[model samples]
Target: TFKYVDTDHDGVMVKGELAAVFDYLDVDHDGKLSYAEYTKYDGASAESQLTHDVFNHFDTNKDGFLQRTEYVDTLFSQMDHNGDGQVTRHDYDHFFTNVVHHEMHQGHNGR
Candidate 1:
């Protein structure tokens, strides 16, 4: 995971490397992120067509953008089981595993 962000392999995530991630996410290259682009997962595990619902969940204010307040606060809150406003490695591991498992279960059931 760290390696994904640290493209230089120097154990550091410089601004350029991180910017590349953002650019990749912005498929249209318009420099603005739409909910559709932001949640478009390219993994072939499943159709993942339901991911747009995640944008609606995060966009509590009906705005077209997923503001940091809603995205960071709500998402981290879900992952931060202890409610300490921070997600530890343990929290991330469990949260990620559960998310993957849930997605897989849903995919199997849906298909």
Candidate 2:
């Protein structure tokens, strides 16, 4: 699941990873995930864990919404592919492409 979802293998998750999950779960592409996608993919485990993990990490100040720092820092790390601490759109697209490929393989592998 991590391999399929982690995209660039940077040991963390970014928008690409989240978008992959969302795309899988948001079959209707309504810009949000719903129960239908969960059941469709048999992703109960991933859904539950994703919910829990998101709450634990993004809620750094225990606030409901993510702060700018938390959101940027979390996604910025992997987006900075060169480790220079700045992220360009290329980094994002590259990671996203990997995410899509990985997900395709996972679906083919039946896990």
Which structure among the candidates has the greatest TM-score? 1
- Residue pairs with clashing backbones, model 1: none
Q: After superposition, how far is residue 61 of candidate 2 from its true place, in Å?
A: 18
Clashing pairs in 2: none
Per-residue C-alpha lDDT of model 2 across residues 1-111, encoded as one tens digit per residue: 445546677755555565565566666665543334444553445456444443344445665444444444554565567786544456667744674345445655784
Collision count for each candidate, in order = 0, 0
Model 1 per-residue lDDT tens digits across residues 28-106? 7766457766755344122354455455556668878655555555656766687765455566667557764576567
Residue range with the least summed lDDT across 10 consecutive positions in model 2: 31-40
Question: Which candidate's lDDT is highest?
Answer: 1
Q: For model 1, state the Cα shift of residue 85 in Å.
A: 3.6
Off by over 4 Å in 2: 41-111
